[model samples]
Target: MPNIFSSLKNAYQLFKHIDFNQLDALSKKVDLPKMVETISSLDEKQLSAMMKMMGGNTKKKELPPIEGDFYHLGDEALKDADRELQLKVRAVLEKDVKPLVNRYWNKAEFPFEIIPKLAELNICGLTYQGYGCPGKSNLMEGILAMEMARIDTSVSTFFGVQSGLAMGSIYLLGSEEQKQQWLPAMQQFKIIGAFGLTEPEVGSGAAGGLGTTAKRQGNKWIINGQKKWIGNAPFAEVTIIWARDLADDEVKGFLVKKENPGFVVEKMQDKMALRIVQNGLITLTNCEVDEEDRLQNANSFKDTAKVLKMTRAGVAWQAVGCARGAYEAALKYTQTRKQFGRPIASFQLIQNHLVEMLSNLTAMQTLCFRLSQLQDQGLLTDEHASLAKVFCSMRTRDVVSRAREVMGGNGILLEYDVARFVADAEAIYSYEGTKEINTLIVGRAITGFSAFV
Candidate 1:
């Protein structure tokens, strides 16, 4: 009533310079109980004002949530139910997967325990129709890819091999009986699947120069060759081996079971990236498949490209997730870590690093969103998917590098989370199709010139 706020502020200023340790010693010579009681009796507003005065302009602005998707692309675009599912999946990854991921990454092992929980999500074959698949749009599938990869890229890779490459091969080209035989069980995680495409000497040029060969016998097709970097092949119950026909020189797909006598898988080791993914060097020494097990409609490399064209969009989404994960980790670290007696995030130079990371992340996310839209509309071409893959993978490298830079030395430590993304990005950059191959696909579309040669 009588300008009590001003009086309270002055009293707070008086107490501001008083050292609590020195005050404790001085209290022995004064009426300590009365002085403490007087200070404690201040009302809520008075106390807040007094604290503000004592703290001396320490009222920092509350920063918004450190979201990697600054443009709210996910929120603005996803339907209510899809958005809910997205968050639910993210919570599961954070609670169940994120806590245990680094340990598995260190050991280069898969957490088989998560298979049951992952199966419960019922997200396999997200875009395919029937055969226990979700039959959702490609957009949803892309989002789920991002969600899985946000926590562990290896798990995402495992899932992609099963759902996109292996299952997709069957879904797109197999006979109805084939889909019925594989999709339901694979969808439930009862049967794991791997895709074998790239050979040791035929990586980026695999589409044209597949070295794996399949020779037709009386009632069986005998496959012979090596497949390098076949994800999940080491443990997959079924591996879809792509081999060229000796008769017509056409590429064909075979569902090679793990117990096949002539099929051998050696676990690839000493990998510098995506260590948790069990990539295999698969050797097919006269691996025999019944004609019934052959992918019925897969007659040529074009059918195989159909599978790659579909999965390549998902790979682009995975790149976005990788970048988002790294950017978010770095942003949170910068906000709390202090340099020169202030939070490093408060500095302009550090803010510039953050902004650039966000810019790249946003660009990747938006591009993937559009790519998924095109896929959903049934307008997705190889060139469109390839362009997104190339752009997102290339930009993700930049984002992860910036993320590591912002964290200084801690960025390289596995415990920090970003180092894994940084390392995993290298694999994402190379796999599916290398940057050069994907760029050529897009290059041909824009200029109508085949630059792949």
Candidate 2:
């Protein structure tokens, strides 16, 4: 009777430690009932010994903090106010935007609900000097772009269209009245904006081959053409359209309002990347704009290139953010995902991939940092911005690819986040400038020979 009681007590202890789900699988090869019986028959001492052999430790080991800023740029470089702003944005993004991104990304829909919340941050036109702008340094603007893209590249692209490209055109080339009318409302997010430059057939050739035409009438300009892949076009209150002038054939910019009779925007669909952004196909059929709405100083493509140069540096920082997000997500996933009874991150090969991602991310971050500094010091050139964009965008693709690889099958899943980064990296690689075009820009500067025809 005492032996029976001892066996039952030992069985209870053994069952407490045994994983029955694993035992069920083991049953496929062995007699699980018999194995349980054998375990029950063991003495208390044997049960304890068996539990110890099974690694008796039930406590989960704490993982290292998930951080992608391995070089401490935020901590070591940013001033107190700048760092606070960065963290504030990061906290808001993780709390509000992060939760809804995957759902919206899957549906290929924009979350208009967050626009008000984002406006509350008052970060638009961050680098502009007046009209309620923040008047911050270019470095700060670059960091914020990184922060936004780190959470969602779609959001960053949306903001870039608003703050960088569209607003930048007016700020750099608009009349004082134009700035006064648009900058304040845009700074407050009361009015949304979009940039229209690339037409249906002209992309890299937009510098010299803009197909959109703007003919100056008695008191207005008539614009007729199609602008494709214009971010924020579908719902933007205003769009900055670049068109070739019929008189001089030089490219000029116009502020085309949404209510214009000839302006129409159709939402682009079935995009594989940056799906949260509502890219639009804008068709302007004899769109008439008052002479006042024409950008006063944007007389030629060279003036338009000024805006592109300024925004290209921000795009480089955006690549860093996308790569950093993917690397951090992959790093966190590997630390928790178990394989062969240990974390996959414990394996040397996985660590190697993680280190490679970090190396690329760090390099991109530092490069953009210097790029922003050059802009702040009035030393930024087309070649400087182009080199950073080319190198960082190319490296971002590699980092995101490795990030997905480290996550294994989960890398492609949107719920994992790395998959979105992987797709969005392709867009970043192509937009603002393509890899080949940017490479040629840098090559031209270095060799003093323009490869572009």
Candidate 3:
């Protein structure tokens, strides 16, 4: 040992300059004396190169940044312009909404200041063909939903209520004159809208029966009932209220103007989740809506189902964003949060959790992407949308939990962002349709059995 590399004085000199700690650690893993003896046969040039390789004699190479968008679906799946629009939407959210999200969530207040900033993007009714809307693909619309919820699901819910549900109702069921009247302003965000399908007594079973009733008079309809968990209802200019028509006993849609004397909304308070959203308990004390305000073609529950069918895909996309927000946040946290003098991200156990999150996130994303594609192809079914909604929402809950697990105590704090995601995932899970209800929807389609009572 000493007679081998010890005879080569120059190679032995390099070893003397090397850090003893590094040598000791390396020696624990390898036979350093024999290794140095073997390398001692190399010439001066190889010896210098070998010394530099073993030590940081040269600059360390930089990696191309690891991020949670693990697959560049935003960059690769979209066309040049569409991809830019996606980035632009993300930029707006990060600049305007992200900074205020935790603060607003803490105060349980809505940020009205960003309405014009969001409106300036002209994304409302993006899939609708007229009324100053962009008339984009369903995929683009879903992408926009994802972009919104990735930052804040409350904003996503707000946007989807306006762009997808409320406007979608009028677009799919509104008459020509009705579309002319509301679609243009709503498309421009001049009139914010809320959808009132879920009542205090009914949510999953709203399709079969509605507590809200509309009695037709000579020229108007009187709407009387209460709506719960109606997002944006407190400030919505027009709320699309679903009511049971007294004469027909069929579910009908009515555009109830906020100015209507009998229409009142009390802001819901002390919600454990989605606090940034302004959920309202709406009271309609004989809310008089003109016959024209009633969705003319909306004669039955089927008409309402059309809007839900389309919006369900967007809800699934929202879940994808929720999971993604958590995954990305957790991954970034792991890379920076040092444990044992190294990044927790470098730890095998932490990385296992990160990969699991990404896998679930990716599965959700690809599933939603295809679901939207089916929508664009005119091949989307209730079951298809339901399947995605059920799967994404359920998986999102798991993803966010893992995300929180990785962050330790900071995961539950609202200021840290992951906590909000964990809270919001609960809303997305139960809303649109509960897991059991959506499962039954899919089950009915495949088995020809109605599982719901």
The prediction achieving the highest lDDT against the true structure is 2
CA error at residue 422 for candidate 3, angstroms: 0.5
Q: Model 1, 337-385: lDDT tens per residue?
A: 9989889999999999999988888889889999999988889999999
TM-score of each: 0.91, 0.89, 0.88
| Count of clashing residue pairs in every prediction | 0, 0, 0
Prediction 1 global C-alpha lDDT: 0.89
User: Predictions ranked by TM-score, top down?
Assistant: 1, 2, 3
- The lDDT for every candidate, in the order shown, is 0.89, 0.92, 0.90
After superposing candidate 2 on the true structure, give the runs of residues whose Cα lies further than 4 Å from its correct spot.
Answer: 1-54, 57-59
lDDT score at residue 453, model 3, on the 0-100 scale:
89
For 82-166, candidate 2 gives per-residue lDDT tens digits of 8998889889899999999999999999999888888888889999998999899999999999998999999999999999999
Question: How far is 289's C-alpha from truth in model 3 (Å)?
Answer: 1.2
The residue-by-residue lDDT of candidate 3 on 1-453, one tens digit each, is: 655644466556567666889778878998876776776677778777777876625566464464556677766668888888888998999999899999998999999988898999988999899789998889999999998999999999999999988999999999999999999999888999999999999999898889999999899999899999999999999999999998989999999988997999999999988998998899999889999899999999998999999999999999999999999888888878888988788899998998899999999998998998899999999999999999999999999999999999989988779999999999999999999999999999999999888
Strongest candidate by TM-score: 1
Q: Which pairs in model 3 have colliding backbones?
A: none
Instruction: Tally clashing residue pairs in candidate 1.
Output: 0
Task: Order the candidates by lDDT, highest first.
Answer: 2, 3, 1
